[model samples]
Target chain A: MSKKQTKEITESTIILPEDIKKEYTILNLGPTHPATHGIFQNILKMDGEKIVEAESTVGYIHRAFEKLAERKAYYQITPYTDRLNYCSAPLNNLGWHMAVEKLIGAEIPKRVQYMRVIIMELARIIDHIICNSVIGVDTGALTGFVYMFQQREFVYDIFEEICGARLTTNIGRIGGFERDFSPKVWKKIEQFLKEFPKVLAEFESLFVRNRIFMDRTIGCGAISAEKALSYGFTGPNLRATGIDYDVRVMNPYSSYEDFDFIIPVGTQGDTYDRFMVREEEMKQSLSIIRQALDKMPEGPFHADLPEFYLPEKQDVYSKMEALIYQFKIVMGENDVPVGEIYHAIEAANGELGFYIISDGGRTPYRLHFRRPCFIYYQAYTEMIKGAMLSDAILTMSSLNVIAGELDA
Target chain B: MLISQSVQEKLINEINEHFQDALVKHEVLYDMFTITLKREAVAPLIRHLYNHEEFKFKFLTNLCGLHYPNQKNQELGLMYQLHSFENNYRIRIKTFFPINDPVIATVTDIFNAANWMERQEYDFFGIEFKGHPNLKRILNVDDMTIFPMRKEYPAEDQARKDKNDIMFGR
Candidate 1:
């Protein structure tokens, strides 16, 4: 290679901008950055420490959950929902089940509905715990995150006892739980409810009044109520903007209407408001669980949909009718009514929705998951446009944009 | 319930009176009032709903593309679910277009949230949202030619030779 040839190649490749004054320093914040907890990237054009403009580049971990849902049977898709917001897998599982039930118009037992309420509320608590504590961690308050994570583990233990799986729990069947909650599961729930509030209060005390934490989060990355609504914000993120639009309250499902709980709202739509709103929500979720436990109903655990729900193991072996039903259910050959329905639940991060179009097939004709994180991430570039780079991390964490849910 | 049957009927009648035959059909599917409209009527109808005093469907809850390869001319569809916080009501609006010219006017102008949602529709099913500022593939790579969500593309890869039954000790 001649020196002249090397110089010519360099000149051709690196053409200088026509106006050098307009050129901004381009920095890739993440496809993987220590600050970004997930596998999404932000292309930030910088003016010193402040961001002149930021472009988010996501789908690095896109798994095509919608396309896969089309090929999977109605019951088989529950596991896929678990991956969407894995911080609260049971919520996704129940949301999917509820959608299926809506399509079939199956009547759920009151006891089963109450059981679902307890489980769903527990999931909401852990979801808020992760989002709030991570915001603390992002604001350089790691002590609170470490302290709150223990409660998350206790919740996970309760989940494991109920469903035999912790993270990606394909917990409940289409109609209801596969079996009744054991005495051990009840004990664990009692234990979690008793211990969780004290630790949550301690965690809240650490950051609610701390001067440095307040300074970092209070006015940083603020958005107005109108902008948040226009951006399709929901759950805690939307409530933080003072909209108070909760799917659970607006369109109650799974006995949520029976419980009395206030939807927490925050003003200014800043990172601090988001953190505080989630903290308050966790407390509300605890109250909802307590209420569900107090007014517990006594009835069958599973709904009367033997064609959809599998029969007992011993019955399947002994009886011909049970054997036929078992084979049909296992082979995904159960009859599904032809209809189109949309069901949304007040998931941890936001309104997690499932829109199903069935053509009376063994599998769904088309299924779409309205993942709230996907919408929230689309508004990220606009949210962090003029903010400092460090505040951008705090804003993203506070929004609780789970990558699996975002990319789905 | 946020919307009663009479309110839903009145809303449908109002939409029909204003838009004429733009509303192709309307039905109540599992308590949700769904209206199928002509493609040209979608963008304007959404804007109208957003600004209407009686029905302020100002928030877009969800939007996605659908494919029906067997449905001859109308191979692609777009569904938009909008909610009115003031009334606590929701409605599903749908429009269909042929695959050869899969174009529908963008709703990003009405709802900023539709920007990425339209991009996602374009990305997966190749339904082009006209007038969108940056209409490009979102969830897929830029250079990929195939729209993965279309019915022609199977969910499982048919070309993988490594996953034969013999290899799995079956």
Candidate 2:
């Protein structure tokens, strides 16, 4: 055993020197975190408790939906829309279908338009209930979340009864809804409308004047009107900054002009203002739904475009023309007009727009969604900067940053 | 009511004067003008739209990438939907790039919202924004190789690969 031979061969271990002087901490805020609403991640650089910088890392729950939409026929993409912003599935479905209809120049009937308005408003209520209540839950108010969830469940029950699906409600087809609401469904919806206001009042009472909630929200995540405009922030988030703009009033897709409603605006564009704006919006939505239900016209629920719309199953077996039309529509043989149309709907979050380009084919040449969550999320860093870590959670919840809509 | 025909004509004249030899086409439908700028002129034109006091399209409402497989000369198009709250008018600034190299200047400085939208466009179509501060895959993972929105990359082609390989890679 010479000196070289006698040396013990220790297990090779590479101990990399840590950057001890760099006083930065990284926090991974989950692809499955509670505040995210869906699978999303944020890589946060922190100095003690303050976020120095945060980079949002999305795509954990991306369905490659836009690409998937390109592959499927126009009708097939309705379900995919449901996956995006599933909390408000009907609105997404309607927005996508309306975009397709606009591209093809398919005339939607007045009754169908009224029905769309009703369903979309209902979807807005469901979305707001979840959004407002989730903010409450995150801010240490648990009872309000339960109450709002109960109300949301009631709305989901209505959806299930009407469309045969709850979360992924592929309710509407290209020209119109899949089916007409039966008298019983209408009655149930009327009942829901009647009961919902009281529940909303209760929900409001829980958080509206609560000192703790107000303390956590007021003056936190304050975005000014100029900043909101510069960032292209739309919906309640923009309205919270006192912008008297609503896509329903501005653009008036699906005959929203017929309805009489005021666009509620907030003075200070803070977390509390956003919440208050949404609360007022829910009231407006309830009124819209009630008005739509009372004034719903009695006519065919769908358009008369046999080539594009699906024929009844009974007619498919009995009538050869119906069968042929159905086959052609399903097989992507229908000739959609060659044009591009941008249809924007006032979704629960904001402006949910569908830009469809048709090359005289059944399938869309190109389809792009203007998801509201995407716009609101752009101000995430601006909103959360200089705020406490817990304020970030509250601010995010108040913003209602739905990952499905964001990633889509 | 917000955007007069004279404004459109004035914009066309300005663009023509600024970028000689660039082809600018306007389509009027749905009470909005979709102004198609040549690829090279898009950045400067957008810059003008932002800086110009008369037009002040301060808000970049939405930016999206469109792939037209059948179009001969202009297959890959980028549509910048701009909304001016001050003027209450909307304009679409569309530009096309060749299939091989889809490159455009990052408009994040003009409109901060373009940061994520450009990232999304890059994620889907492999469109490169030359000066984007943090241009990376947004909706797609960092390790993703193929741009999903390209005409050549069909969903089925990726579906054929193993799920684990597609997501995490082999």
Candidate 3:
């Protein structure tokens, strides 16, 4: 227990000089850190301020969405999908509805398609607004986040008008929308369209040319195009890496083929490129929304599939067929054909896909959500390997790793 | 650039020719081509598809596991959805194996993205990836022994007996 005994023990241990010199500090970034933006944890092995190695730990909020989907009816699963990218809940809802529509072979009307396009574009705009502005917030500029959040609230108001909910707006039905966009909703949309562009321009101007912002993000956490693709990156992240593989463009569903928009790309695949790509994409989404509004098709909003689409309350009370249809749907007794279908949508984050396998049952036999956040999150350790700890935080914010989607 | 029916047939034929009998069954449903292949053929077939001159599915869009307890020996299955941006084609490659021996070769060598996906599959369905560098529970607790996604495991708690599925017509 004395100094002489300690010296003897150290002499016998045979410690290498390199081992002492290369000693690394282990830093736990978060299970609940403010910078993580979500509930996931990152264990970083560091040498002073530089991250030597990084390991990401997720599933702090794993709700077993797939297993839950197996028990719920086809329509019942839409609400769960809403929780997956809560920033753009309507996209998930529509994606699930479209998957069911694909399985049921329900021909969605042109009006329904246009309505979906409008809502989806709106969702895309708000999602990008959040991601790009958060990148600003991470780079020490809080003004943009505060500025753009008001626009997000306006978008949420539109969603609330469409569905009676805000955050997890289970907006649409399997066959089509639960109801058509009310006049008030249309007015809100028009208002948003009229105002959002100017606000977006103002937000972009705040950070796009700021010297400090550029210095923090331009070369920080860059990934090669091949590396990004190999890591299964999609949506804005993949497009930021210069591969223009958008699910909406490649496999157009809900009449995306009818719309005209350009996919924005970036060269460096760094934080700056990602922010720029998203910024340009927001503009494109605004244009797409304008187009959808200009070319709005006039027809029945909901499809004629009574079994999947719930009947009106008055009709259910009066008509026998409507009552039966309502009963069947509410009781989850609607016959779903045994089939396997994978429906992918260009969700705000990436390619959010629903892989559903039905077995002629009331519920899906097996359901898997190809959550883009979960797919892209695996690349985090590789991306942040040797970067500074602060740069690692910026990379995460730019990546927009939503814990709900990641753990779903 | 939707891949035409003839082009889909050609891709199927090429897959058949390249892997020869490893291709179990292929079908075009809802304009999406899906092929069920032998378990051993998955990694090589994926590699071949990745490097193919035409219909090069260089990008893996999704990977997940499925459980079919009533499928006798083929109780566990893995689905790999690949995409070719150039061809604008998406192909779903599925393979099944016995649940008792839920082991398959890892595709991380071909696609780095497959690392977490394979681990997730392992976590949910207990499908062990043979060459996975880090095979562990991802979205679930590390100490948890059961694969929660398998058909044998009930989605809800077993203790909840008050509500009956039959009463709800499920």
For residues A1-408, could you state the per-residue lDDT of candidate 1 as single tens digits? 756644456656765776356657999988989888888899999887889998888899899988888877789999999999989999999999999999999999999999999999999999988899999899888999998999999889988888899899999999999999999999988898899999988997899999999999998888899998899899999999999899888999998889899999999999999999998998898999999989999999999998899998999999999999999998899879999999999999999999999999989999999999999778889889888999999999998999999887
lDDT of all predictions: 0.90, 0.83, 0.89
The 10-residue segment of model 3 chain A with minimum total lDDT is A2-11
Q: Provide a comma-separated list of chain B TM-scores, one per candidate.
A: 0.91, 0.84, 0.89
What global local distance difference test value does model 1 have? 0.90
Once fitted onto the true fold, the runs of candidate 2 whose alpha carbons sit more than 4 angstroms away are A1-22, B1-7, B29-32, B69-73, B157-170
Residues A13-117 of candidate 3: C-alpha lDDT, one tens digit per residue: 897776686778999999999988889799999999999988989999999988888888888888899899998889889998998898888998999999999
Candidates ranked by DockQ, best first? 1, 3, 2
Better of 1 and 3 by DockQ: 1
DockQ versus reference, model 3: 0.65
RMSD of 3: 4.9
lDDT by residue for model 3 over B1-170, one digit each (tens)? Answer: 23578987897788788887898898876657888999999999899889989878898888889888889999899999888888788888899999889889999999999999999999998999999999999989999989988888887764687776786642
Which runs in model 1 stand beyond 4 Å of their true positions?
A: A1-23, B157-170
- Sorted on TM-score, best first, the list reads 1, 3, 2
